[model samples]
Target: MNPFSVFLRARYGKCFASREAIARHQQQAFAHLRRHIMPRSPFYKDFADQPYENWPMMNKALMMEHFTDINTAGITKEDALDIALTSEEKRDFAPMIGQVAVGLSTGTSGQRGLFASNKRERALWAALMLGRFSPSFLRSQRVCLFLRANNMLYERLGNALISFEFYDLLQAFDLHLPRLNKQNPTVLIAPAQILRLLAHAQNDGAIDIQPRCIISVAEVLSPEDEVAITDVFGVEVDQVYQCTEGVLGMTCRAGSLHLNEAYVHIERDIIDEASGAFAPIITDLTRETQPVLKYRLDDILIPDDEPCPCGCASLRLKRIEGRCDDILYWQKHDGGLQMIPSDLIRQAVATSQCEIRDYRAVQVGQHLLKIWLDTDDFALACQYVEQNLLMEAAKLNTQLPELNFHQGITSHLDQKRRRVIAK
Candidate 1:
């Protein structure tokens, strides 16, 4: 079957079916994709003889090193990067090499990554996204997507029933507000930080659009930001966990984040078994242009303990913990390094008695920690945060680092919002 047909079946037919059925569908898709990719992609040629499960894992570094040979689209890293960079600089998403679209990652993981997709892939992506993201596929709706960079993948969503608009994040919010209010989009998608800003705007009556479906993407949706956005919008905010690699997961009707098992297979690199925290080793079966077989991602995710009420048998995720790079390392008593989970630090700050509005923790040096707190009572919030962090460190059997409180810390427009950063 064609990719579009597969996407339609997965989106319209089998999405709400039993887990066994979905698994069978995925198995078939995986087999077909493996057969298709092995012949075209030189990077996977060595693993052609090996079982899919026995294949070696690939990472960003490995992908960058073998970029010329890995992609089946016949585009070099230099040419693709040139196109992507030019598009970013000129704010022109229409530039493409033949029928393939080249896009660059935000480089939050230290090294930026490039991705390419042909026309068929973009069409399939649009169909699948519409089926999963749109509130009602039958009814016509308008979509407003705020992104750091625009691409043909998003632009193709515009059709008779759906109107797609891309709002560049680099542009000021004030400039977009008037246009957004005029668009009156039925579906609004933006990063959590931008959503927070929009929430404030809506509260202040600066914007007057009521979207039926609101999605938080690009950034981790903090609990506080989620509540604020949901409360202001008067609707449950959904999330799309997409990256440079592929579309990994999206929120279901029951508000549970379920992995897109039909398009990808995930292997957990477990970090905390008790909490179901692990990094994802993804094998994106739908991708033929750029084969992503056994690719390890840096983002940490917590799998759901119970089955989703919606009964979609795909794997469910409880939460998206920050990146592994954000996990701070501390010196152990035995001269070894011990890692502190970002969740622990977030919990320490979130559970404080003070009315903490926003906060960030940065590990500046080996034994120094800088914290930024945005609250009415900065002194009290700072004191409470310090005490809680000290308690958390004590529980982890590590000495507390020297703590410094900072005020008015902000994330730049071009940078990814990270609550816990290790410098």
Candidate 2:
């Protein structure tokens, strides 16, 4: 075995052995972050004087603004971007020892951000995910990875039983489908939207191949999307909340999505007046090349206040609420703040008996709500939804905001569409 591989096995095995042991390991990890990466990086050095417990929270905007100065070992934002972009073009660049891998995201909030991971960091991620999520699969499984770009770090997954074929989403399906269908992969992983499309193709008798497992990544999977995809594919859908930032969480065998305890520590605080769902403030213990210490994320995560039935004792995320930008804001007549909850909007619409396939809500002002409903029974559906909203608002002792209903299909920039927009 390779030296790096051996090191990975040893470190991750110890970390995943038990939750208590992993906490002990994190103490050492935090020490390493303080001693080595922080002092070397100019941005982290500003926080150097602050106690680790008192480090200031950060977000995408802050990271992008001070990108050059925050990276450890004198790594610059330019270098990180160069590696990420060049690697996307298939250039091979070896990351320094203890230097984490950097990946950039096409940010939904208008600007892109960087995600860093070292060798040991990636190993811990793999261990935490595979060890708990897909224990039945191994290096012997044939894996098909569908993504926009496949990087060198992802290339490491190839082994005797674990051969991977990267299928780029941008390419024409006709060019790759025949070859892939012949290979007959044992595991298929793709974005939830793409997986649904694949399921449709199979149902239409376009493709015939069964995989042992299926993983959904990149986009959020609506309950409807999840049910349809799983039903047509005939397998339970596994979700990985991953992006250019980091592998945030993965669905375990027991179906509960668990956070990776070894790499990241997440805290939640309420940012808006709406659902009161806690927004994520992240502390990445594994990032070294560019340390993401106390970074705040815009993507709102649903917290599982209750313990999981799964035996593994790890941080549990209940569900991911849509992004902060997706939250609609309303102006009250009394000049007080009264923002409508996205969850309430979703619940109100979802409960309608009408088959409203898709919809988007735009806030015209603080008191006016412009709703777009995509269904044949637009009038009936709108009436049903408004009644629900009125009932919910009454329960909270708040007036039902005026609703202006429109009938049309909303065009999306990315493959996935946001159900609500803060206009």
Candidate 3:
């Protein structure tokens, strides 16, 4: 299929007019993909006789274990990893196996993931990205993407109208400042941390780029980071919820992130019904080479109770909470463990009286909490944060754990920064 045709279809075509329409589209796409992959992919051979919905959910461990057999392309896990790692080490993204683009995940979740996309997949990705990310295709656009790894999939986004540039996150920030000022890209995309850094540079007059749009990708955009970036750019910081699996969602004009229901079918694994929080079991119906059917993700997402004003009928997300493993557990008087939501921890820190520049809270043990903060008055900031957390815990009728304060918390570009973590 011509990529431009796909782009046009996604942009102007009424692919998702209603909930029923989207459901029908998903059914058709899933059926088509299953038919194409069942015969070629050995990992899915046994599932040929099973109903699509009845198939067992696949996780990262299973995918890694069966990587060679799972992929329709005859690429081994060893070879793919070598290719992806070589590109990262050399700081070159030109290498490819045939027309397949190979890249590695940041390994933030402990195990690095390898993803492969053939030429067609690359085109589809670029087209869909442009269709969603661009405000208007009629006008020319320049995009500067700050990411740890680059691949042909991103490079394919470049065209006459849309120019694409990849700014390696591993490179020094000082090196990026001059290039960013020169590029003055209309669209700036980066992780929340990088966006925060750029926001500081913009505030300090070190970088001058008035991007029409700023997108947060890869990392969870905390409330603090979002406000800082938005304040600096004078634009609502939008987000793209994508992973190695596929492009899952894009923020609409109303600034609400909606899942691309046209491409993927999401099955919510509800954890908290009251908050509409769930881990997504996604099946990317359009993916053929490496079929992602009934794949479970670790990240937790809260659904928006109110309908989006943008009127996109797709499923909307209120917030992307951190990983399921990071959800803290607190012991109650009844000896039952009560769940401490990531949002609650975030709120406690965010609403603290002292101005906190940066912070991280990690449950080091069952009854131990390690708090790191970067602020002007370390002692006062620590006291305020500890008190706020204690108050929050009291509301839940749980005793606050032993709190340890650290002077500063540093973040690295190669890893996803989680404000709240559980060890």
Candidate 4:
């Protein structure tokens, strides 16, 4: 597929009129994949004719284990991982394996997976991102991205018309403020936490940047933080929910998060039946280098059954909740474990009437919860947060965990901000 073809395919190529139309389009995409893409992979060639259900389920561990065979580029896992690691260590992403660019997946702390994208794939990604999410096509805009690391795929977006700059998150957060104030990017992209930091800086008059578009990536942007950032910077925060797998989804013009069903087909792996919460198993139709077929991401997504006002037929989401591994549970009266969505805990602190600068909820034990809040009057904030959490627990009809409150937020700027974690 050509670079411009991705734009054509995403923007105007296919707009399903109904869910059934989406099904038919996905059917054709899978057919094309089975006929052309699957035959190229040694790992999948034998299973090309098998039923969809018969295809193996993939995850980070399995992908890494079968990397060499799974990729069409004929590169081994060791070589790819080595190249990716070296690039990250040196903070230089210029090295390439032939025409293919290799990068590492930054997930929850263990067994970081390797991802490969050929030159064509990189161009397509750039086109899709620019075509779909760019703030304006008519003006010469500067797009600034704050990321843990940079890759060739991200670099592809920089050209004569657009000035694209990547700020390494590995550097101290304070170091970027001066440069950002001077750049005054037209489009600002960063993880939700970094955006929150920037919002605070802007509020304090430390940095003055009025980005026309603010895009949150890499981390889940909670409703409170979104509001905080939007209140500080006058633009609604658009979210791009993506990972190493591919660009799974992004916010539409109506501010609803829609799965990128035009190119990526996602299967729901239900987690909470009552809430209709499920994890995403995605298959990217355009990824020929390293096929992402039936790849299950760890994130929990809450669906919105209502159609978006933007008239896009893609699946809508209420929120991209935290990872499955971080799902907090409470012991039930009937000896069962009941799931308490991390969002509820987030709300317990965020929705409190008192001002809360930041917080983290960690389930350290079966019945022990530790919370740290960064705000004026720490004791008062803790009391309010505890009461709210207990009220929620009572409403849910579950045993309340012991609330342990600390003085301030205990997290680093460089790490992906996870407000709620289960130990």
Candidate 5:
């Protein structure tokens, strides 16, 4: 990355005069991408002069199939995968292919995503993350991150001003408590599940530490969990909506989840107009090693049209409503299919008027919804949750799915939590 680009982005990336200004900035960035970056890649060189929309839509499997061609770096997919797998197995993610670091995404089932990030990309990422979320530039800050796997890109974040530490999620999570307490980090970044565990630990007086910022990443953070964490920590939990694709979005100072429009251009694949829910097709301006243009992710996002009080001209999200495949469809009175967001199911369980610890809902059949609830009163929780879901179905004028309730939590700590599932 250019020194000037890194400096300006880290300083005033989030500040936008207006929405139109954001668009104009994106236009210039995309043009630069086409002119300077695309020609280097054999795959994209052909499309350098074409409109961005004319480019082929990319997904995990397709990206992997053409990985050797898609990446600007001369590294082959087989070589990259070997490095990533070795890193994962040895639990040491410091190795890389030259200056480019390779990481794998444990995407849906058998389809895995291979991502390559150069030194510049890593530095740019550090700049953006520290710019918006870091407590202070002058003060030496310790940052703790928990993840299933580590990568060289993450290791690059460590420097004189920032003490970066990665807690391996594959290891026993309980073992991390002592280190966490000792570090007393200024920033805590982890999946929502790990953050919840820490929150519980804090609430139970098992551990004592108060970080300046708590960031939820990888997994979707429910509204209920967010409030519960805020109440326990006495600080609002921030969220960084990211995946192997890139750092797509993060929570603004006002605590609203806004797209990283300063660095990435996102095109909406509208799923539902009524709720403004859409899947994102991203074209990251900063990515040069592996260009992620018009790459559509399976995640479904509900966008907030109302401008945030912080006045960020970037797009704001109401919530991430799980994956597109996780979305359940019900039969309407008119015999049409009605799409139901995962949030509606989550809300039904959250507001069931019963004290609940954890829950998971899966659609086993067209009209069969399998649910698991962890609560003191299983019967009452089931009855209220079923009633709430039925009421919501009635409001939608759609047929209600049969609720089959079980009595325990189905999620494991090490794995990414998927509270809502559709099959």
Candidate 6:
């Protein structure tokens, strides 16, 4: 192991790993964030003058509206997107912009955000990931990292024992499924949606290969999806909840989501059950290029109350709820908007013991609700759900709206299957 990685392992694992350690690390990391980026970065400097206690929170809309002023010191949003989108053609995509790497998201919520990382930042991420997910892989194991676009940070993991291969899911599954199965990858990291499809393929006798373990990323791994993926792969289906916003948290070996306490600080907004859903207020402590200080995220995160089996002291995140965009809009008696938590609805439906493997709720009109499930028992299950929803909706003080239950709601082109859809 390198000297820096050893130091990081001790500093992050031994020293700043528990709740007490996390507090101390955050204080030091926040101090360094202010000291290092505040002076040179214009985006951070503008907000640096604000009181630390009362620092303004930012969101994606604000970042998009003020793209130029909010970006990192030497990069622009347009330049970063152009470079990221064009990176597919380059052999060394990450080094195209020197030691810095630019990445863009699919922007499922309308506008994509830009993420930049220098060599040191990339190494820190790599080390943390390696330490948590595959300590064995670092010595000798083949790792397959599935991504939409290739970058140096992702590609640099290629080694003799740890042979890294990046495959784009955009390609035909038939083409790559065989290749991936042939490679016999030791560690398979991918989005949960893709994993679920692969699981389905295996059940249907299309693909016949097993991975040691599966690490899910990008989207929320639903309870049903988790079961299917885990069963098909014959391994534990863990999740890593991260994005362009920041490396918010990752699932530990014990199957609990532990925030990356050494690199980021988080403050969450808890929505009253009577209101709708809680959103996250994020602060990226390690972002030097485009410092995201007190940025609000659209995605939802559950509270950490259950004590984890894992001994890590970092704050726990139970589950990443749906995004703000996924919230269903409804009319109140006062003629205003009231939102419904899609995650809550999914939980209600999943708890029914109705054999509902997959489902989607689509709002056709103010008074219409379409519920689609992937089971033969959906009709009988929906009958019970219809009554349960009426009682549940009454608690929320909204009409149950017409309920139409259907079977087999096909997956979208993006491969994302939404449980609730509001028009």
Candidate 4, residues 1-423, lDDT tens digits: the string is 588887876565645668888899889999999999999999999889999899999998999999999998899988998899998989897658998899986776555888899888888877787777677778888899998778988885577778888899889889998999899998899999999999999999999998988999989998888999999999999999988888889888789999988789999999998789999998898899999999998999999999888887899999988888888889887788888887898888877888888888889878899888889988888888989988998888889888888887666766778888899
Give the clashing residue pairs of candidate 5, or none. none
- Whole-model Cα lDDT of every candidate shown, in order: 0.83, 0.69, 0.83, 0.87, 0.87, 0.70
lDDT by residue (204-307, candidate 3, tens digit) is 99999999888899888887899999998998898899988998988877888898887889999998766878999999877777778899999998888577
Locate the minimum summed-lDDT window of 10 residues in model 1.
8-17
lDDT string, candidate 2, 366-402, tens digits:
5677889889998899999999888887666666668
User: Against the true structure, candidate 5 has what lDDT?
Assistant: 0.87
Cα RMSDs, all models = 2.4, 4.3, 1.9, 1.5, 1.5, 3.5
Please report how far candidate 6 places residue 204 from its true position, in Å.
Answer: 4.0
The clash count of every prediction, one per candidate, is: 0, 9, 0, 0, 0, 0
In candidate 4, what residue range of length 10 has the lowest lDDT sum?
A: 8-17
Evaluate residue 219 in candidate 5 and report its C-alpha lDDT on the 0 to 100 scale: 92
Q: lDDT tens digits, residues 66-106, model 5?
A: 99999999889899999888888888888688888899878
**Cα lDDT, model 1, residue 321:** 83
By TM-score rank, best first, the candidates go 5, 4, 3, 1, 6, 2
Show the lowest summed lDDT stretch of 10 residues, model 2.
1-10
lDDT of 1: 0.83
Residue 167: error of model 3 in Å?
1.0
TM-score for every candidate vs. truth?
A: 0.92, 0.81, 0.94, 0.96, 0.96, 0.85
